[model samples]
Target chain A: MDSYGLLIDFSACIGCKACMKACKEANNLPGDPGDHLSYSDYTVVKQQGDVFYRQMCMHCLTPTCVSVCPVGAMAKSPEGAITYDGSKCFGCRYCMVACPFSIPKYEWNKAVPVVRKCILCYSRIKEGKEPACAWVCPMGATRFGKRDRLLEIAHTRIARWPDRYIDHVFGEQEVGGTSVLMISPIAFSDIGMRNTLPNEPLPNLTWTILRKIPNIVITGGIVVGGVWWVINRRMELEKENSNGKEGKVEK
Target chain B: MGRKGKLKNKLFLFLPISLMALLGLFLTFKRFYYGLGSVTNLSDAFPWGLWVGFDVVCGVALAAGGFILTAIVYLFNAERYKPVLRPAILTAFLGYILVAVGLLFDLGKPWNIWHPMVMYNPHSVMFEVAWCVILYLSVLALEFGSIVAEALKWKKVVNIFHAVAVPLVLTGVLLSTLHQSSLGSLFLIVPQKLHPLWYSSLLPLHFFLSAVAVGFATVILESYTSSKFLKRGLELDLLVDLGRFLWFALVVHLTVRWQDLFVSGALANYRPGSLEAIAFNLEMALLIGAVVLLTIRRTHRSKLGLFFAAMFALFGVIVNRLNVSIVGMLSDTQSGYFPAFSEIIITAFLAMMGFVAFFTCVHFLPIFPQEDHNAKAELKVQLSA
Candidate 1:
């Protein structure tokens, strides 16, 4: 099955925040939406001068959150949506620390708190429906389709109007490509996106070290055992030699 | 001294410990009753604070004396260092137990801390750390258990543990090697977040090497402090030998750190007056000062000199951990996290608790050498008479 994704056109956004409202409604979130992403708000639209930027989970192909979660609580779905299982969460908040985008937020005010983040409306997508934010985007700013189709649309729009678009897809190469693709007239960095992220997936950094554990264990055990055997044997030999010398002197 | 005087002396020590523990308990209640934000300065941006940095990271590293001493005495048969080995193992056992307690305060769902045991995430560094720590804690318990069993005159149990002493120590050293380094790997995922000066692909090696160095320093500090408090003769010759080992460890650590910094071009990011640079420089200075102090014959052989050098190395390792977990990430996180008063008190309480445990074990158990134990017993008998 083709993985689904969201294509966000920053130029087309009118700063209405209808998508945010739709998200809050669909997620059953209460209270007024905050200016930033929080437990109460899964998605937020921020005004940056003339353009409005929407911030949410990037849902990377190989998400750092998924890999860092010790209990397998945070996971990437086959539908290309990153989902979180609060029940399975031990609430170490490692996901919050590991996320390059700083997407995960903690409910620090709750006695039984779990990490909160955008799940990309995984259930809705499984039901053959687009995410609430994408569906309710009045200006068609947020469009949902197959990842490949979305990337094509994003690149086409960028190529069709060089003066209108930045000629680059924001998430296409960042952190090994995210499901959420963005096209903006201004650089994404100007809108507060991390532009310095490497093209490789973030999880690879940790895996490189973790993969060495088996080798370290086997080698470390052998070295320790070898040292113990050698030291004890030498000590025994010295004891035996000293006894023999004392006996010979007595004779 | 009469029984009444002995009771009074015990009260003198127990009073302060009880008060601090009570206060810590109250604050812990507040923390659990009203959520982390109620008592902590942690926000969405800065999810971790003193609990993770000092309590877990530095705590685990400081406890390295256990594995180091065990490896030296058991593996290499350095019988001279055996006098301090029991105390070192006891410290490590308590250190790990307290680390688990500290995590209870840090985890949002403290109940699910055991999730790592069942839930497998082979790809995660945390998974590796959790397993190693768990296994190592058991190894520590078994290692320390022999001492406890000896004190209780459980000859059969002690004999059983002694039979497997080499294997147990080997397992412990292996586990310590993995988790000590894996703790550094935890931050590897946050390359973009951590400052360049502190971040390196060789972080695991740095962590492991520094842990070994700090382990020696901890053992030295423990020896001096215990000797002073117990009114016993310091193990001068053994400590001088340890000083040599510490010097070598710190030299290797410094060489690797500097080489990595230069090769990675992280030195280019160094601004002399910046916070990270200052922290990095301070850590390097302490470590280098310790090495220099240990190198000098007069200082290396002197008690005060050895104590100060060990203290310097311990403080240096503490600063390095804080720099990695907190200060280095400040520029990228912009969280501006200063730990709350409760956080500070709880950490102090945990550390005080560790000291109390150590002293109590030393007073009652055979944590020290047989001669020392006999001397103390004779002194007590004379006092009672």
Candidate 2:
């Protein structure tokens, strides 16, 4: 089965925040909707002048959080959601530090805190239903479907009405493609999206160095062991030579 | 002085340490009960703060003396430096133990600290570091165990430790090299979050080289301070020889740092009065100053000059670590973080505990070469028994 994705069309959003309300209801979150993502608020909507944008986990195809987690607590689900296991987390917060989008939030107030982030409604998607945000969007702004189908739809929409949408699709290739895609009339950068991320996945940067550990171990072991042997042998030879000379003189 | 005067003198020393330990305990209780937000300045924007930067990162680097001195004395056969070797190992053992303690304070679910051991994630740099640190800590304990066995007159245990001494030292060195660099690798994923001045593809190399330099400097500092406090003759000759190694390490580190900056085009990111640039320049200046001082014949031979040079190099490494872990990320994160009072007090308490532990070990165990003859005599008696 193809992985699911969400296409957030900023141009069509009327900013009713019905999707935010539905998300709160679906996730059992209480209190008024927050303007920024927090432990209690997994996803948020903010206004940048006339444009409103949602901020949440990007759910990268090759997630940095999953790669950085020492305990495999952060995982990329088969359905394209970046799921987290609180029980598996030791709370080192490397995930929080490593996220390029700065998505993961910590439950700092609780004594036994865990990391919090959007899982793209993993359970709902796994049951073959759209995420609550996409299901409740009053203006068809947030659409959920197969990632490849969404890409095709995004490209067709861009080509059909070039004046209505920007030439670029926001998460199409950013950080090696995110499950959450976005299309907007204005530039993504203008609405506070991180536009400077590299096209390659972030995890590759660390893997390039980490993969050399075996070679390091083998080479380091040989060099150190070789030096130790050679030095000890030289010392033994010197001691033997000195003893021989002393015996000859005494004799 | 009489017995009464000696008791009073000891009491004077004990009071402050006891008070600080009590305060630290209280703060730790609060943190465990009330959570990290109650004790630290950490937030979503700054998940890592002073504890990670100072206690764990810098603490691990400062403890590099054990593997370095072991490699030099055991591998290279620099037996003349053996007098300082035991103290260096003891200091490192204490440093790593305290690093583990400090990590518990910083971790949210301190109870789950053992998850890294059971759960495997080979791709993560953190997984590599955790494994290396755990294995190296065991190796350090065994290396330090020989001293304990000597103190206890355990002839059989001492013999076993001696039999495996070479292999133990080699393993310690290998583990240290991997984790010292892997600590820097932890930051490699955040190219955009970390300031470019400190962020480069060569971060692991930079971390490892600087650790080697600081390792030598720390051993020098340890030697001078221990001799002064214990009323022993200063090993001036051995320390001066160590100074040359420190100077060489610093020069190599400085060259690599600047060359990486140039190659990465991060030099363009430098601004005259920016905090990151200022911190970077200060760190560089201290390192260069130490190298220059050690190069001079007058300073190289003098105890005061050598001490000052080592001090400069040590501070240089500390500043570089803080710049990488904290200061460099401030501009990108846009969240200011100053350690809370409780956090500062706890860190100070941990440092005090380390010092106390070091002093106690020196007083009790045979940690210096000058004590070797008597210890050997005791061992012979135990063997004959």
Candidate 3:
């Protein structure tokens, strides 16, 4: 299915944070001056040395949070949003460990808490509108379009500004390709983003080990069962032979 | 056997248990009423704290004794080990119950803990863990139930349980192995998050191997404790036999771990003076010490030496689990986590409750085979003579 994606050109962002304010208002979240994403905040804009970086969910193609959730509470939607279902979340927080981006935040203050993260404004996409963050970006730093078209846009910008931009698109291949792409002038790591994530998905690492369990169990069972049978049969035979000897002695 | 005599005998244990239980109850109520932020030091950067790291993870690791003993006694037909099987199963059953209770307290919506049973995410390691723990707990109950039947003179019920004992024990073993490894699998996604020393592709194998060693060590510790307090003499031969197995498991585990480190080029992680390095060294030392002591005939022959070795091994497992769950995950920037007063009190209560349950089972159930008592009495007379 055709999927949508977002591209954030850090060089173009003015650090204004209008996107953050618009997102809070659009999602009906509490207004706060804080620059970190929390349960009450879906997205934020942080400034590091005159560059503004939008911090939110990457909405990964092979979403680790979705795979690690015991109840399928976190999900990757067909519309390219990484959605969350509070009704299915029982607060195990395995998703917290599994997310490569460390995106999912818990409602820790509430007695009944749920995981919270960016949904890429799936509701708006369903209504044929842009995400609030993308719509509010005045410099066109945050652009939303089809996933293929976004990749083209991100690459074209980087190729056109070789001296101005880094020769990389941060999320294009990070942790098996995220829907949130970025083009930055400085190194991704310098701006506090994890740049060393493996190109393959994180979930595959666990699966590689888990896949052997069924084989081990079956083989282990057979081996153990065989040993038990042999030992019991030998003991029974020894008992029978001793009974025969006693009968002969009595005779 | 007198009422006043019995009360006095257990007075020491009951005082601490009652106090801790009361405190734990009060704090637990506050936690549920006021929410996690009012109780724990957890935040977005530190989502998990003492309850998950210590109470649940360490609890499960320590409870591996039941599966190990059950497999040896039933599947391998080592009837000599059968005496300790019931006690092991009882400990495991209590351990799992405590783990479940710990999860309830740690979870934000404690009431929805059962959602995994119906929701069914096969890809999730946690889903496997949830199912395995629930299934294995049932297996332990049934296995321990046979002991209850025998103790209460329900011969027919005992016979029925015995008929299905082999399969029941095997299922327990399978389930135990799955969850124990899955606990390690839980860390697999956090390669960047977890320190390289502890994180490896062989994490699941490391968890399983260490658990096997811990299982044998816990059995030795339990036997030692029972012998001291319950006035029963040590089962010298059985303890030594288990010690040999413990040694073997340690050797295999250490070998594989070092090999994994070498292959992964993570040997550089052993920079001396780092907290992770120190913890890693201490854990390795304990494992090596236990292995050395267990290999020596003199050490295994003496109950005191065996007890120390077992204690060391058990501590090693504890240290390793804590390092993986809490210490290794700590990045320099994030605020460190320390167990709140409520967390510590609840953990102490759970441990106390395990001891209480063990004592109750020993008093009421046929935990040890009858012949061991006769043998012990004979040995005691010979020693006195």
Candidate 4:
């Protein structure tokens, strides 16, 4: 299966938010929610000094929202698109807590605002088109393709001009390899990539603990149940014995 | 059977009902007319508030009394504590239901809450936790239902229930253990986001221990509160037995708390002026006070002192929950988030529900044993001697 990935080279990137504008247009998003969290602005471009950073869904190998969602409202396709379903969302906001990137935003102002986030424009891709953001990035900073080819592009650049790029590819191992990759002159962690996070998927951390809950329930239930049965059985027997003694006294 | 009556016929039910009715009306109006934005102090920085933290987490923790006390008396066969079983079960029943109400209000799309069950997010911890809570609530309802049936003279039904109660009690305890710890596990994912002092991979263990300690404390308060209102004498023998359990659990909890602190290797966070330090000390002080009070045979035996200790434990539990949910939110602060007056009303209303249910059950119901007969029998024996 094809795993769609984006490699952003901050060193080559100029701080033009044309990609963000194109995403807004392609998604047919209505602008400026009375609340910024709703109404479908799928992508944003953030700048720190000379560097321009593009922000959107990482299409994480293990999306926290997927793990924490009680319903299957949030899903990650085998092809690696992180997807959402408004109809199924209970609007628990647990996904918001679980997401490391903090990308999912809620429409709290509405009677019911399901969580909103980037979806890689899978529909557009299925129709033989690149994501709107990549198509509009004239500088070629954000390019979408198979991850192996993207890694080749990243390594070639580093070898060609060693000092121009850091020795790291940001998404290669971050949160179990986000589909969106980055090569930057500055440290990725400084730009909020969370370098200290584990190389494994984020879900692995919580799942280890969660998986044991059922076991605890089963074992603890037996112990408690066993005790209750023994005690109650003894109580019933004693009452029965007492009744027999009263019958003898009557005779 | 003749003495038994409906909850509405009971004395002292007036105030809690009136308070609840008014608050319910306000909350309903606010929810429909204005929406969640008009209510809670929730923001991108904090998506949880009193509804989630207090009503659900702290409320459920306090409600642990049902399983905690039952495990002691039924599972462990501490018959000395049997007098408290009925009241503790009553509190647990109300506490879990109120938690459900709080959760319904907290949901952003409450209308779709059934999505979890139907949609089946197998990977989600929430999916697991939600199922567990629902099951546990049913178990609690059944546990308490037996006592109610017994009171209502439905002995045939009660007999059937009595047969299955041990199994139900086991299920309830197991369910309680899972969800109680899962509440802490909810925060474990936000390790970087939460203040280091509050977040731990061992959050499940921490949550379980704290709840056990709180469970014992709440029973203490409920006993005193019931005795005063129902005009029954305080059970000193039971209190002493309960005091021993409280001391043991508190010591284990303290040891774990310190163990967590030591393993973190963040000793500097424990300094006098750090926000974490103050909260740490305050919670510890309250918990330590509970422990110390239990050690004193005279104070542990005193109804007034015992009640205060229980109150202190409740305070400690509340402080810890708030620290995790609000103060420990790991994200940078966002602009302007304050809970609307409507949210406050809703919180108050839940408390009112708890009081109303508690008061109603105690009066005109066999929630408290017939202490008068027992006391008279004891007096007659002493006179004969």
Error of 4 at B139 (Å): 1.3
TM-score of each: 0.95, 0.96, 0.94, 0.89
Candidate 3: regions farther than 4 A off: A245-251, B1-11, B368-385
lDDT of 3 by residue, A28-113 (tens): 77757466878878877877787788888998999999999989988898989988889988898888867888888887777787
lDDT digits (tens) for residues B1-385 of candidate 4? 5355544455456665786787787767677566677777676556777788788888889888988987876576666666667888999989998888888888888877666667776567688678877888899888877766666667567667765655677777888888888888888777667777787788889889989988898787767766776666347877766667777888898799879878887565555776667877787788888888877877888877787777777788788887787666633334334456778788888778778778778775667767575643343223211
Which candidate leads in TM-score?
A: 2
How much lDDT does each candidate structure score?
Answer: 0.88, 0.88, 0.83, 0.76
When summed lDDT is taken over every stretch of 10 residues in candidate 3 chain B, the lowest stretch is B376-385
Fnat for model 4? Answer: 0.68
Task: For candidate 2, write residues A202-239 as lDDT tens digits.
Answer: 99999999999999999999998998889887777777
* Docking outcome class, model 3: medium
Candidate 3, residue B338: the lDDT equals: 74
Chain B TM-scores of the candidates:
0.93, 0.95, 0.92, 0.87
Interface RMSD of each: 4.4, 3.5, 4.3, 4.2
Give per-residue CA lDDT, model 1, range A107-167, as digits (tens). 9988999888888888898898999999999999999999999999988887888999888
lDDT for A75 in candidate 3 is 85
Q: How well is candidate 2 docked (DockQ)?
A: 0.61
lDDT-sorted candidate list, best first: 2, 1, 3, 4
Best by DockQ: 2
What are the chain A TM-scores for all the models, listed individually?
A: 0.95, 0.95, 0.94, 0.89
